[model samples]
Target: MSEHYEDDKSRAAKASFYHAYFSLKNILIGSYIVLSILVISIFAVVTSKVTEQIITEKENRAVINSLRNIDDRITLKLDNYGTVMNSLAYSESTQTLLKQASELSNQRQLELVNEVYYRMNEVNVTNTEINAIQLMDLSGKKYTLNNGNYYMEGLMDNYFESPLYDQVRSLNGGLFIDYSGAYSRDTNNLTLYRTINELRGTRPIGVIAMSIKKQALGSILFQDSDLPLTSLIDISGITVIDAQKELQGTESAISFNSFTDIASSFQTPLYGDNYFITYLKNKHYDYTLVNRAPIGSIYQDVAFIKKVNFYLILFNLLVVVIIAVFLSRTLVKPINELIGLMNRVRQGNLNIKMTNPPLNEIGILANNFNEMVTTLRNSVPLRKEQLIGKLLLGRTADSGLLQQAKELGLPAFDSAHGVAVVEINDRSNIDASGVSIDDVEILLQSELAAIHSSALLHILDARRVIMIVHGEDEDIVPYLHKMLNEQKNIPVTIGVGRFYASAEHIHESYLEALDALNYKHLFDRNGMIYINDIQAYVYSYEQLDVLEDGIVHAVKYMKEEELLSMIDKLFITFKEQFVSKEAMNRTIVNTYLKIFKLMSDRGIDLFGSEQSNIQVPSINNIHLHAGAHELKREFAAFLQSATRLIEERREKRMNETIAGAIEIIQSRYADNDLSAGNIAKELHISENYFSKLFKHETGVNFSQYVTTVRMEAAEKLLRQTGNKIGEIALQVGYNDANYFSLCFKGAFGVSPGKYREKQGN
Candidate 1:
């Protein structure tokens, strides 16, 4: 009882320990999971925002510095061009040429043109970025030199409607720069127009318009940029010059008028969705130097960074998983092993040595556990014997006796108890093997151990082992009876007492066992003789004569099993509850006298049949037997002969029964829990006897037959059903799909799922 109680306690403890262990494991893994997600999210968001900030700030600064530098240099160049144009326009040579070109002879006009052209060439030497220098008069006459060519294109077709003519016509001083295309066809050029005035009267004479190739000016301003195009846009939003010629005729995507009012550089969308712009405005000229590029091209650097970050995160995640697994195993393995060792100790394996102690708290615990087990090993078994011995003898427990018993794995329950005594018969008289009965105790302990049950067995004397039991009773007494009866040394018998409430009443049960043990003399064979079993068979002496005619009638019909059952009842009454050995022998002889007289009245021959060993020993021989076992052997031989006659009656139906058993196996094969013993019970047959006939008729054991039937069914289901493999496995009575797959593969060389796929279903 104490053993079982302690077992339950240990089981509960183990359950709680594993609960904590698994919970802690999940928490640690979950922490890593949550932490990894948080880290990745935060890292990605922070990196993206910071990169955007840096890119914006850096791009802004670069646009400002590049535009400002270009603005300063271009402004200075324009001012220089203004100074040179003024110097040329007020020259005495220019007034002389303009005045003589219309008044002089053809020869003098040609000479005057040569003189003006040479003057213009000198101005070009000082300002090489000038593309074409032209002079136009109020009378529509024109003088032009392009790219410092001596053979210049003489142009001045119409000056009245040109922006250069109108803007310069209003300027009394300084240059008027026109970024708008000089002509619709010449879109890549812009003109700076300055009006030439009479120094004497301040009257405008002609407009000197310079058509500068915007590329030359842009090259000077934007030499440092990697951007594809940098250009100057006029107040009218027309692009003057671009490094890439594609935008030469295009209008500025951004409005220069909006930006010209600002004191600093700024950015805006340009060309709609295709481009972005950063611009610096020259308010003096209303010519903005703008840097524009495609958005995708600009963000290329950032995209590369994002890809690198993603790979880095993947590498870090892999490291985290590896470390998580390593740490979990390192921490959990030792504790799991310690738990394993502790369970072994709980299960009464005192010799098990706990191994691989770690160097921390668990190590200290391991050392303590080893010391504790060393102490328990020396005392537990001996103390258990003493504890049961004192209880069964009805001795009052001394102070701390209960505590000591509990420490040795006994529970201190106050109720529900019983006892059983098993006696090993003396083998000296049997001429059997010489093995000592005490040596069998080791084998009994293992056979009696249960999943969570407890009982204590003690050897009380040379031939008796007493078991003090508590809690539930199932097959303990019966299994012990079987083990004892099958012992090869000699006949052994068991006697079980009735269950009694109250722990202290176990002594009463112990006494009852002793009384029941004395009834063993009636059995004449190894068997269990429960007190209740004997009570069930109790009868009066007057009943013996009445039973004799019935017994003889059963024997005449060869009802062997029925007749033997009656004898068992009569003997239990005669020996266990009522008569002494001598009185029992007298009653037994008188019972046989009635049986023989009945046989005589029927005129049946008492001699044995030649077909059977149906011989009755003389009454003197039965009376002279030394023990119940030898006397019962004589009766058993007589019963065997009668059983042969019954077998003759059964021979005709033997094959039919065997075939019926096969049908039951086939029909029940789909039940995953089916077994041979349960099937025989349903068929109303003894399992032990049914097993032999099943094997003989089927060429396989019952379990093997069931497996074969299930396997065939599983194949049919796998081929025909559209169900999933795991679902089909369950339908065919396999609880585990993987095991079913393995078995199927072993039989058919293909897994169920693969086989179904092959059928194209």
Candidate 2:
């Protein structure tokens, strides 16, 4: 009985432990709650300490950056204004106007003022913030230019007598006044005053004043409404700008306590409220920028941050508790579901799916599994298509193809079969028509089914699809035409080959189909071409040689008419001789090659046409044409362009040659041997060609032109000096003095001596 009680107690303990182990969801939630509380408590303590420091540092950095930004903008704007003033002071026009200010007449001084007024107008227009520009000479006479009805009244007539003038004059730089009260309506006016001294000497010439609206300075301040106060104070403790316009020209509220640094931040009281102050001294101007904020706002931000951090920590702990429970339920469930899915896939069930899967690694595994199954499901048909492609290429054995075709539900092979290639004439046309290769294939399959013919279709590429049809007597051309008529939007060309007696020769029919398709240029035949219907012809090499020579000769000499006629004759000859397509291709290629060779041999730069931007047609462009008519048209256009280029080249060369001949004539007219023939020999041209070309270009025969040049020289000699006719004759390229006199008389209608005597008279 004692041993029985011990066994029962041991069983009870075992059952309790197993019961606790089974309730894992509750255990996990409880553990997470405890851990999150401890972690959040520790985190809160550490974060509170660090956050204050970080917030303080960040606020300081942001305030400093704002100060720098304001400083830079003010400095840049002020410097620009200063530069404009300097330009005016040192300008030649300004200097001249000022120097002659006293001695000039009324009109002259008015003219000078107009010059300076135009300069002032430009500055005022560009810097619309400036109110007025006033120029005062040494005698206190004022010249002012204003824009948009902004004129300064003389409320401060004693401005020159004030200490401000003395202050600006004492220093070499400009001085800024807070409010000049120059405008009667607006008392808050900021003016820049400087003495305009002679740039070359130190003598003071004039005082120039520029007035700006106070709001312009206010606009440059950092626009933060939270700040209680911000001000720009001069070194003399006067406020130049205040956010409140009433404080302008008043003494600053907060004292610096004599901190002599460029920048300082401290806590101070302003108007009974404790405030934090940040100040930066401007490097370019005699001003200090000061910003102040209430001390309560800073502590409020810190308190708000601490409160937000505590709430955030509590919210995170709650999320961790919820997540622990959720993961305890969901993590194992998805993994198990994934394992089951994988098993089903392993069992050859590719249609299984996991719905609303958890977003974790298991979800990725499930998606990949689905994709893998889909690929496996599609691989059979893909493999069958590949096998058919291989069969058409003669890369697969007939036995293997038959077995795979049977298993893959492909059309069975037959003893007599033929391959037809249906090529889309233009892929763009198909895209424009909203039809695809699949649509065309389905149409073809439906037509084949309608005709009760067994066939297999595979899209070879984007533009072409190949069909292997069973039976020797089945004619697929009519069905292809039917499909073409059904789909009027997509244009197609069908090349059907003769049926073979064995499957092994299917690739031969494929090749033959492609061959028939290429004959679209010769016999389009309404886009339905058959191998057996195409007629082969023998070409004579001698005939091709004659045609090629004619074409090349026309292109070489740039004869457009002859080239067109030759191109026409080429096709005509091909038709008359019934030349094969291959021979026709060879003929066209050989013609282009020979023309290109001629261009190379003659050093003709195809792109040397400066008069026209039309590029010479590339020789490779010939291969782009697929039809006889288009090829003929493009070839004609190409040859025409070539003719124009060659003509331009020849014209340029002829002009250069004529110019060279004229240069030789000018330099060698005194040689006495500068005949057209001698010059032509030097220019590497025949005398007749040179003479005719020269007359055509210069509107004069070579001999007459030469004689004209000589007579003009002789006439100059007679008028300018006392040289005799014989000496001038030798100087002007005439060996015989008597002949020179006769030639000169013919040119001038007077003998050389008579001309000289007439000129002397």
Candidate 3:
């Protein structure tokens, strides 16, 4: 009885569990179907909205582009018309005709006016857009021609009476639009579009006006469409305001109010019962372009889009139903497996392999997934190694590995005994040929060759190349010399610093290299220099003062030969005291700084412009420890430029002084005691000093200058008066007649009698 009851209870429990499991499965399926419908509906609405926005934006752009195209065409036509008018109005023949017309008889004047009209008609006929051409004088008188026939009497005050006339007149030269009714002809209802251009002076001479056909402008507004559009309405709300149509045209009388009310009542682009109204603002005319498009006609495309969207939605729903069924079964397992693989990969275990079980398409997908993992596993190490190498060579800044390197306490330098900074001067001239080499490559090759060992090289910046060399050899000089000579074509300068014991002291070596390079200007052709060589070239500060005094003395005395000799002596003394490249460079750079400073103190600008306002790099930053030869060459070039500038300034000052002296001499030429000695005494200078100064300033001696001035006065007196030669000579500060005659002969290259006879007195 107990066994029977237990079996019955077990069967009942099994039945209940299966029934509940099936019910849960049905509930999950129903939830999925409802969620999927909601998601698909949301996606469809978003997609439709996005598509509509894109289409609307594209249409707006198309409209703007079309308007711009039309505006460009009209602008071009107006520009061409203005150019023709400008050419004719400023022509030499037109000026000549106008000039002749003023003085000619009434009959001749009429003929000349007719000729001018004929010329204008020819220009108009060539341009089909131009209906008529008219020329008007400043007095509001118009002379118009139509098909070579002249109309002289019925002159209208079109531009002269308009408010735009003064604005056009103010341009002085160039064309401006005159919106006033200037030349309104009857045929074709053509109204005047005057392009008034002024002559190249203060006065307004004439105006050029064209009668533009209204139909030509209307065609531009409407273009290839069946739509009705009216364009170029003025600020006063008038259509066809600046039109070329005559007063008799049917479209000319159409008021701006007729369209302005209808356009204003509708939202910018109003689609109405039969037509859609739209308007574009014309910036050139400061007006509006109004158009009316057939409403049902223009929106036919919009209606088609609606119909297409409805069918697309129905088709999309069918696709969604199939996609839901397929995705529900396949997505969960593949997605879970992919997540696991990604987690393993992220953890650096790229060896993770996915299993391919034969069940639907998941087997094929699993095979592809395993292949991807294998490729990634094989490539990661190689890429990481390559990336590390690139970072060490300064090709990249790998912050991750760099941080790791720092944390691991990796040595910044390999067992380097010393650091050297090698810089390539005139790097811009480097030949970039094989391997896309640049100035940096030239520096790298030169440094490696110089060290002749596996030294670490780094590009610090555009201007500096740094290297660390291992070993304790004190005589790195020979290697440096050979390296520089070998790479002479590159024109690189190597600055070697004092050897440091460890990597941490590399900064000290860097400073030494910089110091050595700074003193490079003291040397000649080979600029390879070492910082330790500077002590040999040290000099007392007093010696620099002596050098300054010597330079100034040479300049003041105007002794070029003596200056050259002094410079040679200084160079020889420097070479004797300091034989190394560093010493020579330091001396050269110091000398330049001293000279420039002296000039600055004396209020002399070495750069020709305002030196005070100019900012130069700090002197410490300037690489001076280049080889002695390079230092010397750079200094020499700088000195040459400075010397030329000084000479220019001196010449300008001398010219001013000479001009003043000449003015004084000319004003006091009648004074009998106006000799060189007397002039020197008056100016408070020695007679000899004055003579030298005068010759230097004017390329003439003081006595010769005085004689020349006196002779000029004598010639002027002889011409203006019936005076004897002796009297003229005496008046011009020549006392003794015989002495004056000799002076006169020297001054004129002839006797006073011949000079006076040559004057035709």
Candidate 4:
């Protein structure tokens, strides 16, 4: 309406610029002429809008196609450099020098260093785009080859930091290119960072940096234009490259920084004339390519044609003026009827109808307009409700919705906005009688004043209620909690979402409320939870995955003490991080189930004969899982029973292994080469593993068991066969008579001769 008023005022000023004629003939002629001019003006305005859209699309397409072609060329060039860098990365000798340049001897290093320099020279010859290549250690200390012939850089602070280098490090290992000043020495040159890793491992051992000079970049960097100036702007809006060296003043006229809300593709005005602009961003390097040309240059031919048509229309208007007078009278009659009907509609009435008056386009238009008015009147309430729903859900189109909301007088949504979720617990379910959902909503709205509420939106259900509130203070969350806590009539649980500054984030607040409500069991006594207080614990809960894996490993290995330590560690972390009680219960139960699954996969059962008397509680039984401490006690007992069963399983396997080893040893006992190592080798077990199992299963060390078997054989030979000590020693597996007599005496606490005499030989 304001725009319409301004247009009327503008026309009134234009009419005052003309002289008035009072003669009847001239007045009638002038009035018809003026009316015809108004129709022609409307035609021109509509034509201009269509032409503007077509021309804008045509120029934007032409410029963007050219920019994309240039972008593709640059990517191709950079890809070649990347391929070369990857080739050098896979070179085994280069990788070895990167890792152990300090470990090589001086003479060997010099010779090896010359070979690397020769290789680098060969690479430089192959790829001339590479201006310089330097290899630095992981600690950023530069290593020179052939006295700085190939690698010449010294230490760089913070391991070569710059805009591009920071991007490369954050991405781990990739081709890093910078038209921006990632290199300190030369901003004109593009810097490259290629992280080189060990040949056989994924560990990055060093970085190789290459510089490509701007001279090598050529005019292609700026698209090499002639008429319109071309420029390459960095991310910081600095013009780094200019194609038209003659038009260096392009910077003074156009500054992208002036348009902070610039779109990816948009036009900007320069000196009151539109400059057709297109946007192309480099996906790899992250700089914007802007192609700009004046709108006049693009539409010059169309402007000439429009001027010719306007002159022709003016000449025709003189001949058509008399005929237009008759037609205008006919057109104005139905239009007057339309004006009256519109006035009725503007006064809030849509029941008026258009009778069958004429068989022309005007009457048909009137009929369609009448139907449209009726439809709008019938759908008013439904549309308003839909808009309100959109506003509450925060799914509104901002400018349009905000304007409509203001006209409809919706509750203001601004900085201090929060959401509260109410859930009916067992106590609440038993006592929610005689209270309608509407009554509850009214109660909540009335109670919101304690929070200094300005507005509210609510959805109530039998089991749950969601309320969105707006307040003036930052203490809105605490006040809402206080109100809900003081409600003794309803034994409900409340979850309050954190406040947000805009209505668009209201959905985020609602999601927070829902998540907080999921942890209701955590605050059983308080019956309320605030998202901000436990948000950190929600993130730290992911660490439980590592803890669960540790528990599984200990349980699988039958390490009962280690398993207990892991459980304590899990609970300690939960306490330290202040993880909610619900989260703790859920994670522990999940981890315990995983432990049982691993044991079941190994064919160990918790309900087997060994565990028949043990009864594990279910998840719904809260008495057994009041908190982490109580849960830990119950879990420890279950783990102890599992450990005993696992130990029994291990013992059976250990007995079979030990019996097999003893059989192999006894069969070969008389052989003097028989020893624990040989016995373990015959049994096909690791020596260390066999020793531990032997000692654990037999209650004696490997060597001690072997010696006893040999000595017993020696005693039997001495007592039963009257063999000489030397012969008995040789029979038993000792190498000499003195050694055998010493062994026999060591076993009997006397010499072999005395033992033989005492046996009455």
Candidate 5:
């Protein structure tokens, strides 16, 4: 009996457990459906709000843009109106009409007035907005046209007091909106656009005023839309005018006041209320276009959308419940598999493979996961290796490894090799090509790798290629030839150094290479030269001194032909003496050093000490080891220095010559015949030389100096004695009285007569 009871209890417990599991499943599904409905409903509401806002903003912008377009059209019309009015106001007939107004008989005057009125009426008929047009004289007289007839009235005593007349008189041309005019009570209140212009040269004519109707202006605003909410007001909060009509009664005043207050504050538009206002201000006219529309009209669809959204939420909740049940069952197996695979990957078992089921979406996700794992596994080693390489390279500068070669018995120099300094001229005019500095350096290193046995290539301070080659090579000529031919795309030239036995002697070799390279302009072919070749042909100090003496003698005699001949001789001597590569380089370095020293001594400061310090050391090495390649370099440097020195000396000597000439002129001031050409002839110099010299020394040309000196003498005579103006002119070497007075007035900022009076005072 006890065993039977136990079996029955076990069956009951199993049934109860299954019931609880099914009940929990239903609850979870139901909860998911409810949450999803809530989320979707919230999303629908937010989307509706965003869409409504976007539509409202876009509508307001469209309205504002339309108003601006209307303003532009009106501005253009006004400008055209101004042009026509200007033409009419300046017409000869209008001047004639004004002149005959006061003297003619009533019939004759009316005829004259009608002619003027008819002309204006013709303009008015063409411009429909211009209801009336009139011309008023400065005396405040009024003239009106009635049914093709002209009627004239005597000057209105209070006409000048009107704001329209005040604006017309003050500005000569203006536009005003008049509240009290002949047509004010009617729909056609006056918008007087006036212009004042001169007639017959001397007469200050009255204004030609065109009175445009207020209703016509209102028609411009109402033409596009029948919307009852449009306004135009000046910036001062005054309603210049609007499309709304003024209603009669006690309520009218209150309504108008409310509108005026609202318009003033509605400078900027606001939203979300029952009304939406869009406003645009005119930059030229002090007026604003205010457009108001009902918010309900813009977003009328929101109410229908809200009701539809509520029903959609209910329908979506029902669908969500069904989808949740299926998704929970379907996602369980795949999620378990993904979790297992992730665990394996985390435990360093990256090679694990999972069978992809025939479910299309799940199969794709599995494939992608596998691909990602494979990529990360493969990339790890490569990234580690790259990091190591970067670490090593970063520890040293680009050229730091070359320093170690010297310690290993390889040749190195503190000074630069002149011939090895090849400037890489940029011939390709492309502003930007994507080539990087690393790419250029890599290319250079690859091309120079084979030559590293005898030479070390380095990038110098500038964008120059510097090559330090072994000076001991029996035939560097082959290497030089190979470099020139191989590096054709990159123009290169070599300055070979004399053979040196020790690393310390590398400086001498460097100098030789530099010297040879300096003569690159002279050599058309790839070649090499010994340092001894340069020293043999360079100019001695005595030779340079003799050249200097020749230049001085030529200038002293004021002989242009002789001076030119000396320059030619100097060039020829330089060519003959230092034509070799080594001589040329030595001469260049020496001349540069001398010029640098000269500038330094004279406090000119040609170059910074740091820059000069580096350059001078390199230059000294080239000079110490003179070579055949340096000859051309030496001659070029010598010529450059010689030219500069000669020019400076000539300038100084010319100044001295001019000062002497000036003294001669001052002593002979009484002689009116004293002139530039005569002075030059007496000094045994050419007239051109004399003129140049005079200008250089006195800061004035020869003729200008003579005139200035004579003028000074004239000033003294005018102040010291009461001489006649004509006599003063003659004393100052001027034969013409007018010419002298004119010159005096120009120099003193006053007429001669005025100047004499001021002096007396």
Candidate 6:
């Protein structure tokens, strides 16, 4: 009984497997599930290999981007420091106080010192990172201004002979940065020093030093919170800043002997951990930023990502299997229906239609099929017009057009015919007349029916109408003229071409008509022009040459009135001389090109305000104009703009020259030979022109301004310094004390001694 039961179960299982193999839905589901598993397995293996490489590459890019950002932050902070130091060193108040500090009385000196302290305090309050500001005079006296961190040691007795002074003097009045701290000896503080010089001379007046808190800079430099180590290192591998306070001013933990460029990365072992190191050199400073991360930690992150990816892949595989099963059921029914409908269409059943369909790709397909059938039904009517247009354009064979025309129940173009091209003078006129080109085409066809009775009209575009008439040129021209006279209110111009014997040659006449229509701009109003009737004149290229010169000269000198008048004269000349359209266009285009070239040669960009390189205008672009009037209008506007640009350039040049002359006068006013002529020669300009320009721009003559500057300096020295009359005179650019007294008397209405006495000297 057991053997019999086993044989029956095996037979039943074999029959079930055969049924599943023959079933389409079951077979599709099974095949998809198996294929999905195979594809997913292969993809997971490949992705595992590729993800590691991609992670490494992404890590490299992230490190590089981090270094770049840190570099920018550090440089910006340093520039802010430089700006503060510059303001303190060159301020007029600071300069005057420092230069006159030693000469003032005990009480007056105390008052000036209070004023200087107030200004420096304001600067420190504005820049919270500043620790303190120190000033050392040429006499070895030092003054300190504290923000909030106030710790001061007395000034060195022999400051002039100290190493700090030597370093400051070595830079020749330029700024000096002491990264190791000179003022406070604190590793957290960096000092910036500047040698204060007289405004015009190279004599050192004093030294100004400012100490900045490194803790303030650390806020921006140590932004890599995830990294194990981040530090700012100098070229000598000394750590200037580090995330750890104790590490500051110590040697960098990573060696940089292999780095040769501004940015570099490598793998190194540090403190028994394999670290990936990336360092970027600051372009404006003597520092390199080093970032170190452990290789084991990076792989740990990659391993976690792999675990998450595996789970996601497993979940996605389940969803894909479910989707495959559902799509197989939903897809087969609509696809089968689509195939049946397409079969009917292929068998020439244009009447079949699909009833309501579900909103999906299948529905879109059904709707498209219905639309395509309707379009085929309507296409027959349009083919006749399409063929006719092609025939007029010579794009279709004449024989092919004849056969199609007979089938569409239209007249065959088998006889002599000529083509006329019609266009509105301006599209703007169409709007002004409250008429569309379609209405105009209808009116034109009605007028043509009365003259030729069998003419066909086609609108090529919004601006043009093409007409085909089966007749001789003599007959066609008269009919076109009559049509033009009847449609006088339409604002349309027509050009008639000579007749050809057959339709194949119709485009030849069409082309000639287009050429003839170009001359219609010469007429005062809309009318008919004939190809044979156009008279060619000896339009002078020499005249165009003269016009170009006139345009350039007018623009160069900013003569707007002359530019407009010349353009008007050229158009009038074209009309009076009966110049052919080609010759007229040539003259205008040549003149335009020459004008732009002239601006370009002078290093002027007419279109772009900030463009330095001259861009040549394209010749082909000129032909895009609708008609002569548009070209003429644009030409006039271009000339006006050119004149405006020239005016702006001249004004800018004059301002720059005046500013340069002022700078030179202020710097050299103490020289005895610093006259207007000498300053003008130094600036590489003519003296007479420079004097005139200076007066025009400054509202004062060059010599008068120079004298004013010198007198002001003399007044300051007389009041501030205890000097002899001869010494003060020479200091203020006066050679002799007697002459200085006379000029000073003229300037202040008092002698030098009297002026000093008036000031309570």
Best-fitting candidate, measured by TM-score?
A: 4
> Per-residue error at 144 for model 1, in Å?
5.1
Evaluated at residue 680, the lDDT of candidate 4 is: 80
lDDT of 5 by residue, 292-406 (tens): 7776776776666566666767676556455456645555577578669978776556677567543744554465557556754675444333222222212223243335433
Per-residue error for 300 in candidate 3, Å, reads 3.5
Per-residue lDDT tens digits for candidate 3, residues 1-761, read: 89999999999999998788668776788676666666666655654565455444433433444455456555656655654565567554455444344666778756766776666655552455665566666555555655333232333455566565765566544445423322342433334343333333345566665565555656776673533343455445544522233322223233445444312312233322454444566554444555444545545555654555555444546675664565555655665786688687665566678765446334544554575567555655444433333432233233454434333233344344566776666545553432212445565566556666555556544556665566554455446545554744655567887776544456567667766776555555446777777665455444544444445445433445555555665566565555444444455556667667755754577565654433332446345433434444444445554555556555675765466667778888878777777777777878887778788876568777778778767756866799887788789887777788788787656787775665457
Q: Write the per-residue lDDT of candidate 2 for residues 612-699, one digit (tens) a residue.
A: 5654456555555666776677667766776676666656655788878878877888887679999889989998998889988765
TM agreement with the true structure for every prediction: 0.34, 0.35, 0.35, 0.36, 0.34, 0.35
Worst 10 residues of 5 by lDDT: 247-256
Screening candidate 6 with a backbone cut-off below 3 angstroms (N, C-alpha, C), the clashing residue pairs are none
Residue 424, model 6: Cα distance from true site in angstroms: 62
For the record, the alpha-carbon RMSD of candidate 6 to the native fold, in angstroms, is: 31.5
| Candidate 3 accuracy as lDDT | 0.55
> Which stretches of model 4 miss by more than 4 angstroms?
1-41, 106-126, 143-166, 199-201, 223-228, 244-263, 267-276, 294-302, 315-761
- Per-structure clash totals for the candidates: 5, 0, 30, 0, 31, 0
Candidate 3 lDDT trough over 10 residues, lowest sum: 262-271
Give per-residue lDDT, candidate 3, residue 628: 39
Q: Which ten residues in a row have the lowest lDDT in candidate 6?
A: 150-159
Q: Residue 390 in candidate 1 has what lDDT?
A: 63
Candidate 3 residue-wise lDDT at 21? 67
